[model samples]
Target: MNAVSAALDDKAIATGPAGPLLGDADFQYLRAFVLEHCGIALGDHKHQLVQGRLLRRLRALGLSSFTGYCELLRRDPHSELGELASAISTNVTSFFREMHHYDLLVDELLPRWLHEKRREGDRLRIWSAGCSTGEEPYALAMVLAEAIEQSGSKVDARILATDLSPQALETARRGEYSLERLAGISAERCRRWMLRGEGEYEGLACVHPRLRELVTIEPLNLLHPWPMSGPFDAIFCRNVVIYFDQPTKQRLFRRYAELLPVGGYLFLGHSESLHGVNDQFELIGRTVHRKIAE
Candidate 1:
C-alpha cells in the first residue's frame, strides 16, 4: 500500500486504545448508562466495543476520562445523551448486506407485495430499523427503483430508515461512502445507484440524487412512541434485537406487530430471533418471520 494510504488507515483505526477502558466500576457505569438511556441490554462481551467506539469521541470532546464522561452523561438530559448513545451504538452494515434477503425481496417477495399494493394507490412502505449510516435502506431503495423501472410498474415506494444515532444519520443524509464500504455493492448496482466520486471526492461513492430522494433518514430511538403510523408492508430490522433483554424485545416486537399488517414481513439479524420474546409472529424462514395478525 502507498505510504499516504497506510497513514490514513492508521488514523481511522487509531480512535482508541486496544483494550477495555480501566476499572470495572467504570465499565459497569457505561453498561448501566447504555441500558438506562438507550434500552440496549449490554453485557460483558461489549465492554471492549463500548470503550473502543467512545474513546475517540470522549477524547475529542476533551473529557478528562471515561469516569468524567460517564458522569456528564449521568447528569445531562438532552441531545448530548442521544449523541453519546449514537457514538457507542453498533453499526456494521453494508450495501445489499446478506444477499439472500435482498434476493428474496426482489425475486419472489416484493413482486407479490407490489402486485397487491398496486391496487391500493400503488404505494409501498418499508422501514429499515436500526439503519446505520444509511447503506441498507439506500441499497433497498435502489433495488426497488430498479425493480420499478424493470417491471414498468408505477409503484410508489418509500423506505423509512431510522437509527438512534444522529451522527450515523448525518452520514446517511450526506450519502458519501468510502471505497471500502462500497465493496459489497455489485458492479451493476453500483453503476445504477451510485455516482463514482472524483476530484475532491476521490475514492468515494455518492448515492445518486434520484435514489437519495426515495429514503427519508430520521433520528429515532426505538424506545420512543414510534412517531410513525403504519400498516407497513415489510420491516427490515436486522441485527438489533439481540441488544435488548427478553421483556424489552417482547415489548418492541409487539409494537412492531402493531405497526405492521397481517402477513407483513419482519427481518432480523442472522443471530437474532423472536423465538422466546414474541409468539405473535410466525417464523417462516431461518431468520425471517411474518407477523400473524391475530
Candidate 2:
C-alpha cells in the first residue's frame, strides 16, 4: 500500500521467490547494528546491498521476514553478530594489490628496515590488517622472502595477517586459490612461492609451506581490543578504513599510530587518506605514510 510496501512487493515479484523483503525499518536497524558492532558506516544507498547479502542468512535461519531476523540478532547478538559482520562486510582483494606499496617496501622500506634491525638484532615484523583471503600477506611474504635473499640478510622477517571474518580467515589460512585469483602474479614468482595443483585440483594453487611459514593468520576485530603488544616495523591496512565514519577513522588511525614505532610506515587504501584523519604520519609516497620521528 505504501511506498516501502510497494517496493518490497516489486522486489519480491522481480526476484521471483526471493527471501523475505527487506523494508526501510529493517535496513535502518541492521545498518545501525552493523555500524555499532563493526564500525562500518553503511550509507542509505547500501540498503539494496545489505538486503542482498543478508538474504542468505535469512534463508539459513528459516526466517520469514527481515524483522524476524533482526529480532534473532538482537536476542543473541554475540553468536549472530559474527555472521552478520561476515555477510555485510566486503572481502574483495587480490595478489599484489596496489603494487606501489610493494615497490616501496622492496625499494626503500625493506632496505632501511633491514639496516635498522641489523643493529637491533635480526628481527622484522609486519602486520597486514584486514588481509582478506591471504593474498596481501602472502604477497608481502614473497616480497620479504625475496628481499632477504637479495640482500643476503638473515632478517627474521614475519607477517601477522588478521581479519574480522572467521570465514575469510579460514580461506586465508588455507592459502589455496583458483587460477582466476592468480592474476597479476608472474609465472616465475608463482613457481617460487606457490605450489601448483594438478589432476582433480587443476588450476588451483596453494601457497608454499616456505611462504606460509612467514605468515601467521588470525582473527582480529580492529574495532575491539587488540591482544598483541606491537610496535611493528610497518603495517599494511589498505582499503580498510573507508567504511568507517570520520570519527571512527580518526580513532583507528590514532590506534595505528600508537602501535607503530617512530618512523614506522602506515599504508592506506588508495582512496583513503590521513590528510584530515590523523597528523602523526607524513606522506612519503602514494597512499603511504611514515610515522613522525619523536
Candidate 3:
C-alpha cells in the first residue's frame, strides 16, 4: 500500500469509537481541544451527545471520522470552526418556556425598576442572550406589554435577542409558531398578542405586529466578545451554558455581572445553578439569580 493509503488507515483507527459507549480517551481529547478553542467543555455524559450531533456534520463534510474532523479544526482554523459549536449547543426554547420567570419579572422586577427610575427613563432594556427560536423574547414582549398597559404606564421597551444559530435566529424573526408550541401561552394572552393565521397559514399563530416590533434579533456567538453595550435591566440567558466547563461558566458570569446594573436580574434555566463557581450572584430560587446591588 502507498504511504497516503496507509495514513488513511491509521487515521481511521484513531477516529472510530475506542470503546462500547465512546472512546473515552478520544472524548477527553476532543473536550480539551474544544475548550481551548471555544471555551466549551464536554463532560462524561455528553459522549452520546457529541457523537449524535457531530456525526452528521462529519458525513456532510465527507469526513469519514471524528478524529479527522478534529484534525481539520486544529489545522484549518476555518475548516468548519463554528460547525461543532452549532452541533453541540443546546437550542431548545419556547414562548415562555418557564412561565414563572416572566411572572417574577412583571410582578417584581419591572415594577421596582420603574419606580427607581422614576422620571429618568421610560425605556427598559433587556438582553435575551442565547435566545433560541425567538419565542422567549416574543413572549417577554407580550408580558411587558401587558404589564405596561395594566400599570397605566407607557414604557418604551426593546429586547436584544441573540443566538449562535442563523437558522434559529430566522425562526425567531419569523415570529410564526405551530399550535403545539403554544401550549404554555394562555388563550387570553394569545388573543391579545397573536394573529391567528388562516388558509395556508392555518394552525400557526404569528406574534402580533406590535410585539414583533419590540424585539431585535441578531446572530451571535457567545464564545466571542458580545456585540452589545449594556447596563441592561435584565437578561434572560437560559439553558445554554450547561455545556460549558466550570471556568467558562465563571468567566461568563463575570461578563454577565458587567452587563447588568446593580439590582438587575439574571434568569437562568431550571437545570442551571450559580452555586459552586461564582459568588457574584445571590440565588433567589431554583433558577432565578439576582445581581446584588453593586
lDDT of 2 by residue, 25-142 (tens): 8789988888888899999999889888988987777665677777776777767776788898787899999999999998888988887676535779999999978999999999
- For model 2, state the Cα shift of residue 26 in Å: 2.2
TM-score of 2: 0.90
Q: The CA-based lDDT of model 1 is what?
A: 0.79
Provide the overall lDDT of each model, using Cα atoms, as 2-decimal numbers: 0.79, 0.85, 0.77
User: Candidate 1: where are CA atoms >4 Å away?
Assistant: 1-26, 44-49
lDDT of 3 by residue, 35-122 (tens): 8756787767888888777778766766655566666766675446556666777677777888889888877877776665546356
* Number of backbone-clashing residue pairs for each candidate, in the order shown: 0, 1, 0
* RMSD, one per candidate, in order: 7.4, 4.8, 4.2
**Best-to-worst ranking by lDDT:** 2, 1, 3
Candidate 1 vs candidate 3, TM-score winner: 1
Tens-digit lDDT track of model 1 for 1-294: 322223333322322245225356878987876776677877798777777778776656565356656656666745466677776666788888888888888887777877766663677899999998999998898878877776766677889999887778889999999988988888887887789889999999899988777899988888777788987888999988767777778888999999888888999989998877888899888788998865
Candidate 3 clashes: the total is: 0
lDDT of 1 at 271: 95
Error of 2 at 148 (Å): 1.6
Q: If scored against the real structure, what TM-score would every candidate get?
A: 0.86, 0.90, 0.83
